[model samples]
Structures are given as C-alpha cells and as structure tokens.
Target: MQEYTQEQINQAESRGIEISTDVKEQLFEYANLIGEKEKVRALVRNLADAVSQADSEGVEDLLDDARMDIQELPDPTIGKLELRDYGYMEEDMVPLRKEAALDYHRMGSKIYRLGSAGSKGEYASKEMIQAHDGLFGMESQMWERIKDNNLDYAEENLGAFQEPMSVIEQEEALKLYDAGADIYLITNFSSPMYVTERMEIERGPEHYQMSMTELERFRNLEWEMQKYPQIQSLKEANLLLGTRRTFGIYQIRDD
Candidate 1:
C-alpha cells in the first residue's frame, strides 16, 4: 500500500480534512506540551540554538516574566509566582473561600468563549464543526494533555492557556474531575475581560492609592509595548508550554 503523498495531503486539506497530523504533531512538539518525550525534546533541541542566541542577548528573563504575567495560569514545570490571589465577589458580597473563588474564576472564564459543539469553537467558526469530520485527533491530544495535567471535560482541540493556575493545581484539578465530576472550559487566550486580581495586602494601605495603571513597569508593558522584547524571552531555559487552554473542559452539560 502507498503512503499518503503530499498531493493527497493537499487535496485532503482543500476538501477540508482541516488538519495535517504533521502540523498538529509540530504544534504538539512546539508547545512542549504532550506526546512522546523524545519527540517533544527533539523539537525543543531543534530550536535550542535559536533559543540560546535569543537568550544570550540578555533579554531572557524579561520575556519569561512577560509570559508568566500574561498566561492566565501557571505550570508546575514553570515554578511559582511571587504573588497570586484568585478570588470571587458578588455585586456587593465579600470574597468567598479561595477554592470557591478559584472555581468561580475557572467557570466564569470558560463561559465566555464557548465554541458551540464539542469544543470546536476556538479553531474556527461554528460552521466548520458542522461541516467537517471530527476534530481529527486534535481534540484527543488536547484532552490527553489536560488529563495529564488533571483537567477535565474539554474535547480540547488545541490546548490550555493558563493565565493563573499552577501546573500542579491544574494536574490535581484534572485528576479530581476524572475521578467522576462534571467540568467546564475556560478560554484563557480570549476572554471577554481579564479579571484584575489585586494584591491589596502586598502593597499595604499606602499602596492602595495606586491603580494598575499607576504601576510604571506594568503600565508601560501593557499600554505602550504591544510586541516589546521585554516580553519575548525566558531565563530558566527549561521549557515553555504550548497553548494555555490545556486547562479547559466542557462548556455546558445536560442532565
């Protein structure tokens, strides 16, 4: 039997095969996310030279911090943050328990970018899912990664964009859900609004006067630099995750 030729691949794509295993594999490896360890490491090693040169320029940590600051959640592999506080509040209610607050964060965000039909919204329009075959094997790969991290329910076409959860907690959350619990999906990369978590305690009463905009470095970074180098590199030289949505789960369920 003949292997699928490049022409066959192109034809399949045009007719809406919608994905190339090669591309997905590349993305998988590129994300440093999941799959065979050797392949993932190989992808990193391929980019290692370029990554090193980028690092050597003395701008590594800046980029790394930028990633940390932007990512909705953090990863176990990436280490811990200097400060983090996830909370939930009603119109006039005091904050709830930390776990509850975290759940609110998770559930609320997932409700926003819900892609109708089995986690297919993120990659394309609603029509695409209706027209195409399964998410290929993409969703499986996505869910597997989330499962490894202990996340639940998402068909996971791509991966998670952790803006806040530590990788450890994420793994635990997945495990908790898999042990038999319903779950929800949150699109970290595209949220309607970013919940600004203020560390009121860290600054003390005096610092209360300052808004997020008052913080110079953060202000400069957020407003002025859309693609500044300060947000482009990493310091530890370990690894960077692929999609931040690896933590996502189902958007809604029926009884």
Candidate 2:
C-alpha cells in the first residue's frame, strides 16, 4: 500500500509542484495506516502459512489473532459513530438459515438414496430419517457459529473483492461441519462475506468514505498490493456491513 505514496510523489514531481509540509505530514500518516494494513495482511498470511504445518488448535489460535487484529484496527467503518448502532434483523438471517437447511436436507436425501440403492420401497428408512436429522443438526450448528461470532452473510456474490477460500480451508470447513463440531469452534470459514467484512473493517472508514470511482481505484490498488483481493467496491462492502439487510434482523451486537 505504500506504493500509493510513491505514486503520489511521482505525480507531484512530474507536475513540478513543490510538496507542502502539510502534504508531507498527511503522507506520513497515510504511510502509518499502510503499516497497520501490512500488519493485518502479515497476520493473515501467517494463518495461511500455519494451515499447512499446524495442528487444528494451532491454526485456530492464529485465526483468533487475525480476528483480534480486525477488532483492534484503527477507526473501523462498521463501528464508526452512528453506524455502530446498526445491525441485521431476524427476518434477514432467517431466510439464510432456512435456505441452508433446505440445501443440507437435499444433500442428505441424495446421500441416503446413493447409499441405499436396493431399497426402492416408498416407506422412509431409519437411515433416511437419521440423515435428515443429522443434516438439520449441522445446519443448526453452522447458524450458531455465525450468530455467536457476529459474522456477516454474503447473500449475493461478492465478486473479486472478497478473498478466495483455499482448498485446505474448504476441506476443514466441510470436515468440521460434518462432524457436528462445537458451534464455538466451527470457524464458519466458508462465508465469503466474513472475509469481506474483516478486510473492510481493517481498512476502516477511509474505505467507506470513498466515492464510487475512488473506491474502485482504491480497491484495485488494494488488490494489486495483495497477492490476491474485490469487484463491487464500496457499495457491496456496505451491503455486507448490514445496510442492505436492514429490512430484516435486529443488531447482533450485545448492548
């Protein structure tokens, strides 16, 4: 992100404009922000690195570290001033839960059919009922994780701005989900919105304050700075932040 400073300096130099002291101070402040951004990125990278070598407990500790970095990020957009009072409604989250439950039920049905090939009878088998029950339980556990962590949902495709989930992360998510892992330990790694939320929170209100065109450029710079990075820019990130979901759940934050 410090490359932004060089880009600015080069433009000013090319225009033959003398850099002012105030401008220099502003640049220095921005550089400090860049340093904080790099720290968060480094922590995330550490989590990614440890995934290959660390045990489950070790990786979880790193995730805790990464998440703490987000909460401690300077001037987070979501918690800024009046917006901190905002939250999603139950109606908003209910549909997501219902949709996931239906999806799980279908998955269970498919598994039951595939496993019980010889049983063509109309009556439901013990295995079929158990499968549905187990999947429902999984869905419940997944929701508990989301609600407990105050994680956001990605109702729409988040485009390129959201971080891509790795294969290892996917395997871990599925494995944990299938095992009915404790809700608190679920991690809820598959939600693209969670990644989007953490990124914007770390970037802070400067991200929220960008105009559409500026936002596009800023996120593009962010993308280039990272080995990977968003398509919708500011508007979509705000939606993930709970603006679009307002017609539905109450705030998830504790009073």
Candidate 3:
C-alpha cells in the first residue's frame, strides 16, 4: 500500500474532504491495477472535472490520490507545459487581467478630466484640489526616476495605481460593455445624465462627477499621444500634462 505524505493528507482535510483508510486503500489498489499511462489519464480527467465543477473537496481528494500514486510510479514526471495544457495553470490570464485593469483606469481618468475641464477658473473644492496635488506629487516623483532609467524604483512607487479590479467588478464591466454602454462612461466619471444611465445599466451610481463628451475628448487625446513616440515616452513617464490637469499615467508594462 502506498502512503500519502502528511502535506497531502492535510491539504485534503483543509478542504473539508475526508480521506479515510478505505479511500486510501482503494486509490492504492486502483494504481496497482492500472497501467501508468492509464493512471495519468484518469488523474488528469478527475482533476479537470474537479476544476470545472469548482469542487474544492474533489480537487483536494484528487491531488492527494495523485501524490500517493506518483510516489510509487517509476516515471513520476509531469511537465509544466502539460499542466498548462490541462488548464491547471493560469499564467496566460495574467496579461489579460492587466489589460482589463488598465482599461478601467483609463475610464476613470477620462471622467476626472471631463469634470475638471468644465470647471476652468472655477474654484474646486479644497478636498478635490488636495487630492489632485497628492496625485501630481507622486507622478512627478515617478517621472523623475523613469527619466533616469530607474524604472524598477518607479514601479515600486506605483503600488497605489496598480490595483487590479476585483472579479465582481470585471464581470460588471463586461456586462455593461455587452449592453452597449460607452466604455468611457461606465464606472469612471459621473454627471447627472451619465449617472442616470449608469444606474440604469449597473443598478447603482458611481461617485465620479464627470461628463461623457469631455471623457470622449480625454480618450481622443490619449490615442493621439501614442502617435508621437517622444510624447508617448513623456506620458508614460508621467511628465506630460493635459491642457487643464495632468494626463493620467499610462499603464506600466512588465517587459
């Protein structure tokens, strides 16, 4: 009979799965009865089923079984590529998640720019001005470091801006996009009309106070900035400012 490592047993138990002596014996007997290739196929199928079903207990049970079988098998190798092919790895999802996050940030910056544009020479709430100052200061510091080819240090200071959207937010954003709502006006900025439209679509109001047309302008400028590599470089480094306020920083690529 094969013995499972303590870690394997603990992992199963942590997911509220019980691996009784009977289950252990059954696994060992099955392994002994099957060819190695058949055993690998069976285990892979079981793992896929567990993942598709979102069954944590089933996953833990299968992992424990695989660990025990691997200990006894002469050829106990599984390649990273194989695991990825089996949908057990999420390495490919990282870039998609980052892109989604950047899209969300761009929308927020559009709203902010739109609201600020209409208020030229008008007194902004002290609180709003203070928030802008804080953001501007941080961007300036980051730009200085980036200009010096010290992106590693600049990245370290960008923790606040790098926050990714939660799963719920991502789903909500997709739903709005699918419903024919403008991406720029989805959750980023707020105006009375935009707020009404957003609440109708999302069943809630976002606190941003920006207009849709101005946000459209912000989006246009952002796209235009990409045509000039030097301008793009300045924008990426947070050194570029809009006619009214600082154009928001571009997303940092992990290259």
What total of clashing residue pairs does each candidate reach?
Answer: 29, 9, 2
TM-score of each: 0.17, 0.17, 0.17
- Model 3, span 22-130: residue lDDT tens: 5455445444333234554466456545655778799788867766754432123332223233333332111112222233233331111112122222222223333
The residue pairs that clash in candidate 3, if any, are: 190-208, 190-210
Per-residue lDDT, model 1, residue 96, is 22
Tens digit of per-residue lDDT, candidate 2, span 68-140: 5334422212211111112221111111122343343332211111111112222123334344322112222
Task: State in Å the error of residue 66, model 1.
Answer: 9.0
| Reference-based lDDT, each prediction | 0.28, 0.33, 0.37
Q: Which of candidates 1 and 2 is the stronger one according to lDDT?
A: 2
Overall local distance difference test of candidate 3: 0.37
> Which scores greater on lDDT, model 2 or model 3?
3
User: lDDT of candidate 2?
Assistant: 0.33
| CA lDDT, candidate 2, residue 56 | 52
lDDT of 1 by residue, 4-112 (tens): 2233334444644443354434333223322223433343343333344544333334334433433423221211111111111111122122332233334332111
